[model samples]
Target: MRFWLLCGAALAGTMVADTASADTLREALLQAYNVNPTLTGARARQRAIDEGVPIAKAEARPLVDSDVTFQQNYRGISPFQDNGRSISAGATASYPIYAGGRIKNSIRAADTRVSAGQADLLATEGAVFTETVAAYMDVIRDVSIVELNQNQVKVLETNLQASRDRFDVGDLTRTDVAQSEARLSDARSRLTVAESTLTTSRENYRRLVGLLPGMLEPPPPLPTLPQTPNEAVRIALDNNANLKASEENAKAAGYDVRTARASRLPSLSASTGVSYTDYLGTLDNVTGSAAGLNPKDAFTDSFFGLRARMPLYQGGGPAARIRQAQALQGQALEQVIEVERLVIADARSAFGRYMAALETIESSQQAVAANRLALEGTRAENSVGTRNVLDVLNAEQELLNSQVLLVTARREAYVAGFALLNAMGQAEMRDLGLDGGTLYDPIVNYKRVRNKAWDWSDDPAPTTQATRTATPEEDPRAQGPVTPPSN
Candidate 1:
């Protein structure tokens, strides 16, 4: 009980020590949102997906091309030997008049897929934030446990010395002294384990947040939560990113089926071109007189035409493609349901854990108080010779255990609550009110690139957005000797 009370006071003091300068949950999340490699990579991938829309739309636009050809004497197979220096230049332009809906459906599918990619990017953001929250809470929990364990080791050390003095004065036995020493040793070992856990948790925090953690302010209060698991499921089914992405994918796949079916229908296009050819006075090199041969002869030609194509026999490929697309559309539709189920399960499970952890925290607090009183009573009774040293030691250990459990329960409750929010699509940047910096908007990039047709436009070279840090030295936990110290 003293440990818990001390920890509470310590945390309060820490919070007040430098509230303005202290690192916060929002700050940590913002760092990750800005530079976390996983989130950045997902954003880049979604941007690439956005280009699919323009690429598909390109099929419906006009295409213009130009070419020039030059011929030499060695290429002449006719008696017009010096037909050599002839040059031909031409330009052709074609515009789609109709495509049996293939181009339209393809563009629709690509556009819908861009929506799906946006949803996927949203999902990735949520997942990374959840993981960062978990890691933050883990470090806090482990730090508190390490502090408690260190305090216990100190208490046990004092008890061990007292036991030794009492034994020297004939008030205690060797067994009593040995028991105290053993407990102190065990407490020291546990403290070492707790420290190692803290180090590992810090490393994980750095992995997510792009820097080593500073003095982390306690997490802010969670948003209002759903009252029941079924309510949570309802919310998740409506808001879950994965489910939304899957739904869009199913729609895109349906469009793909239509695009494939369009292959059997006749397509029409308009084409026009102008050509210029110059004999380069090759006729002047003619060995014999030829009718209408001019010293310099050149001709210009122009034409306009329309073309229509229909698939008469494609070796059953178009039918197979249609069937394949239909099956995939079915698969995509099924995936939506599958993801919905997962979201529901995740929401309910997280809610259960949060509730359970809250109860454990309450119980552990009570247990801590009880064990604290028990330890005080046992120590007084031992002083009066009514209780043994072993009983007092056991009570102290119980108090420490209860305090550790209470801390852990609180951490778990916080993490689970955040996870529940994540599943419900309420743990994103906008949801968290993280005002640390500008939030990433996938739509801005999507809209900018989706309808672009400029051939000369270019994007800046991609540079890594993630931050780098020096790796920490090898942890003692990982570098210790294989064998235990001999007793």
Candidate 2:
């Protein structure tokens, strides 16, 4: 029966899938950075933003249009008198010679908005990476806790069996046996909870990493950190994506104000047009010219001229718009200040929490060692009849508690370190070395579309899904493991 029980346990263990080639955190991050659906959507949105520059540029270009007309008229009541018929065609072209700087300022505003969009994209990328890291760490933490709980259950089972044998031999009382059974039951209950937590963490991992987690490798050492919170805040102020975006937005709003003011100034434009009409033998002159379809008979006219207009007044609409834009620009500038303060506060808070977690790790390690020794001493004393079974059980529980604390402390230390990196705005691909070949450079797309008046290319725009050429030697997978930057 004992042999069969052992075989049953072995078979149960085999039910879990083998994961010999455990996935590394770096590999998970690379997968998320490269193909996460949220990131792909953001890239597509940025490509749409790149079109705004070209749309604004259209204002300074020419406009051309054409029209054709045909007409027939009947003369008063002479049956054989000639009928009047005419056909006409014409084309007109208009070019804006000057628009009092409105066109230029509009283009400037659009260019600034594109810059702001790129910064927003950067912020989104950072957020996705942060979530992926959190999910990866959660799985690792919960798995370790589950294993620890399982071991505790096994240890309690052994203690319970020993207490039962002792009670039968009169070495331990019924109360001692009852205590052991109670502790074993409690350990089993905790193990069930730990298993549930691990399952939840794995589900979150699947959501972020695009696959259910296999066995995950332990994370490597943390990245280098600043020596002080002040230094971290300084870095955040300079590099935070949200801060940069707000500054760009403020500049765009300033240009908007300029564009509104220019609306009140004089504007100039030039236009040219030509028209032709032919009455194939109208009633008025049909017989006089027997009009051999000659070139001189068709009525034609052409004219070209420049015109200027100044807006004297229009119920103060332009002035009201200018004021509105100026107010919005002020609001944008204040938002920059708000974002800077928020970044600094987060940096300092994460820095403090990380330092506390490091200290807890050291303290918990010492506690675990001390509690382990105390448990051993208590058990030996009970074997020699100097201590009771209850004392031994209490010491064992203390040691288990200390072990759990140590595990939690280590997890907190690693997670807090990453939080600090995120607060400082350094949690991006280039900083983390996750940017493989063919980095998505928004500037490339902006330049491609900004000066274009029309899209005549057979290929689509340079979107995230567009085909890109890469060098034969550039193997993206060979880029090597992503490591933290040196301080």
Candidate 3:
């Protein structure tokens, strides 16, 4: 219909005007990667875990401490009868010569735990990016659907007007006019629903991307896909963060078992100390003896020795701990296997969905083409009196329905492709080519904190002054939202 043609042209013009300010999927994802609180928190948590390595290593290092003691003694029943003051200061150092490998195993366990934390951070990043991609695509898909519904409403309105004209001239019955009116009403209602869906989709986009969506450009194609489901599973097994984390945990648990067993073995250490004592006043009156009865007024004593300890008895606690650790290690190992199986299953399922979506897109395309031709033929036949207004309206409705399905199928295909990538642990900023900002590397923080002790200034300084405007190069999509054209 001419009305439909005009509507399409107007919509095209609106899109072109909005495209100047459009937000792209890549930009949205980049903003999310840079500002998402959950991902930042995960990085912080991993840094905290990295400190455990130094804490465990400290047990194998020398410990030095200083103590000062002061005391006043009063004799007899009166405060002034007899009084003496003594003060002593001492410094002691102890170094563990051997701990039956307990400290070594503990350090190993801590290292593995840090590795696991790093993997957990990677997993969190992937999840956040995956969610951002979906939110970005959802807004674009919903907006397109709304446009399609609006066009349908226009086409039905034109059909209803034509039906009314025909009925007034007795070419069509009143019942036929009513049918056209009822279909138009239905189309309007669907348009309202579609608009509501678009509003919801925009809200979701804002929640993930840290800004409300403007005119969204179409999404880009997904990254190169795996050749087969087996290939996808292979990729997932190799790159999946959850599986890596679980494997590291299992290693840590094995070290814990060793640590617990070592607790029951003998430990050897060496210690040395020097002490100085001073008497503030005579103590003869308090002791009822000579003025320097205790010893020299000022004296120093030095001593050094080796100490050995063996856990001879602890109510069977050490043995029980070893058993508990063994059980925990077994559990961790099983978890690793479980995670691998789940990852494989998820990867295969995602690939299947992606393939199905591609097929649906093809089917919907064919349907749209067929229905468009049918609508044109129905309109021509109606003009020649072979088909009526109802046939034209029905054909138009079929075409509209096919268009809706096509748009939805395309959206699904894109989302499913990303889903497959996510399952294979490849749905991240680097893989998506979303180089909009500085990429966060968890290793930078880990290396800074892993060997640090009693140091808070080791963290990297901010790159820029507290207040400054962003440079043009820093934000690639500063002009507006810009998504790639839909395939």
Please list the C-alpha lDDT of all candidates, in the order they appear.
0.85, 0.79, 0.79
State the RMSD for candidate 2: 11.5
Off by over 4 Å in 3: 1-18, 76-82, 285-287, 292-295, 455-487
Residue 364 in model 2: shift from native, Å? 1.2
CA shift at 357, candidate 3, in angstroms?
0.7
lDDT of 1 at 272: 99
Worst 10 residues of 3 by lDDT: 1-10
Superposed model 2: Cα runs more than 4 Å off? 1-20, 69-87, 277-298, 455-487
RMSD of each: 7.6, 11.5, 9.3
Q: Model 2, range 152-210, lDDT digits (tens) per residue?
A: 88998999999999889998889999999998899899999989999999977777767
User: For residues 336-373, what per-residue lDDT tens digits would candidate 1 score against the true structure?
Assistant: 88998899899999999999998998898789889989
lDDT of 2 at 1: 8
| Worst lDDT 10-window in candidate 2 | 1-10
| TM-score ranking, high to low | 1, 3, 2
Quote the lDDT for 486 in model 1: 88
Clashing pairs in 1: none
- Candidate rank order under lDDT: 1, 2, 3
